[model samples]
Target: MSLYKTEAIVLKYYELKEADKIIVLYTRQHGKVQAVANGARKTKSRLAGSVELFTYSDFLLYQGKSLSTISQTEIINSFASLRDDLFKMAYASYVVEVVNEFTVDEEKNEPLFALLLATLYMLDRGEELELATRFFELRLLNLLGYRPQLDACVDCDLDLAKIDKVKFSSKLGGVVCADCALEDQYAMRINKGTVATMERLLEIDYKKLDRLKVPESTRQQLAKILPNYLQSIIEKKLKSLDFLKTLTMTN
Candidate 1:
């Protein structure tokens, strides 16, 4: 066994026993980590607050052959505001869930780690949640090597400006030019503003997301297009998405 320290954000957790918990963390130095946090369920336990979902903290761990043990923890940013509001909680949950789905254990993903931290901070501080999430999704896809082709047709080399029509093809991993529409018959029809929004999202800093105003029509298009593209990549619908859908219905 070896001892090491890292900063991580709680992704999710489960009760391991009466008092212990299994915490899923996305670490800065280590990608995704699961370790036992003993006595975390107890009200008096020091690990209680630090292990809560979305808490960014410093940890001292003992790496074991089969699993790691969280020996100590200190909260860096609790981001408690996200848990206090249902609307914020729901959208942020979807964001973290996407990160959890796309990553594997023990991989060092510094860029993704920074991106997620920025996103959670944005959510916590009450930035425009919808636009923040859209930015997070686009940036996350880029970090995971799944950046969709927006500059030209995924099926053909043609520049999209020349084409009067463009359709988003998740299978082809980008927009298909008008000439290549038949490539994916189920391809999503996209408009100029929507395409421009996505392109801008790809390039903009997540912190400056507020500066880019997204019209409701474009937001609706993004709501449809991005998730469909992600579903194609991941091959399964995220559970958190269903939760978001339910929230929308009740509102």
Candidate 2:
């Protein structure tokens, strides 16, 4: 079998027979990979620490007939601070869940991979979780080709400056003018500030995310609308999301 090395982030890990683990990882070169790590679950194993969740590692793999084996794993970064607090851990988990659900193996999603790593690093360092989440949502949509229409109305092509109410249409993949919105009944009305917030999110980097002070009302609106829009596009429910929400409420 062929052997290779790559930089990877542990997305999740599950116990196998007794002392082995099935690890799902996102790699910089190979995209996502599912590999078996023998003896990774045993205490005092050399691979045990490197295979922990949210850790980034350099891995040596042997390509097997049924599944790849993790021959070796060297820890690159552990984000150990994340394990100290529940909020940070939960936020990081949410990010990982989204990455795991949305990405596929060997797809070469460099941007998405970078985004996840950056966000997780930030969360581990105790950045504002809400801002990080919003940044993640906007960037994720952009990556998936569901970039929202924020510049102008979908139909009338108005500058949006003249429009006070922006109607978002999942069908049209963006906002539409009141008159233009008649074409799609599923559209929801949003204020001009919310529209502007969406635009800023698209243009700005995650580091500058906190500068945009979105009101609770606008945040609530986006919290509802963006997820609904994603669900419509993704066409499936994510169970990890439910767990994330529960953790958010209790934490």
Q: Indicate which candidate wins on lDDT.
A: 1
Which lDDT tens digits does candidate 2 get at residues 1-251? 99999989988999999999999999988888999989988888899888888999899999888678999888889887766777787778777877787777778788888888888877876867866777787889999888987888877788788777788887777888888899989888888888888878778877776577878888767766776677677677755567667876675
Model 1 residue 203 CA deviation (Å) reads 1.3
Candidate 2 C-alpha error for residue 235, in Å: 1.1
Candidate 1: stretches off by over 4 Å: none
lDDT of 1 by residue, 1-251 (tens): 99999999999998997899999999999899999999999999999999988999999999988779999998999999889988889988998899998899999999999999999999998878888888988998988989988888888768878778888888899888876878787789888789899889999977678899888888888988898788888899988888887886687
After superposing candidate 2 on the true structure, give the runs of residues whose Cα lies further than 4 Å from its correct spot.
Answer: 155-159, 179-186, 249-251
Candidate 1 C-alpha RMSD relative to the actual structure: 1.3
What are the candidates' C-alpha RMSDs?
1.3, 2.4
Q: Clashes in each model (backbone N, CA, C under 3 Å)?
A: 0, 0
Clashing pairs in 1: none
Per-model TM-score, in order, reads 0.96, 0.88
Give the whole-model CA lDDT for all candidates, comma-separated.
0.89, 0.82
Extract clashing residue pairs from model 2: none
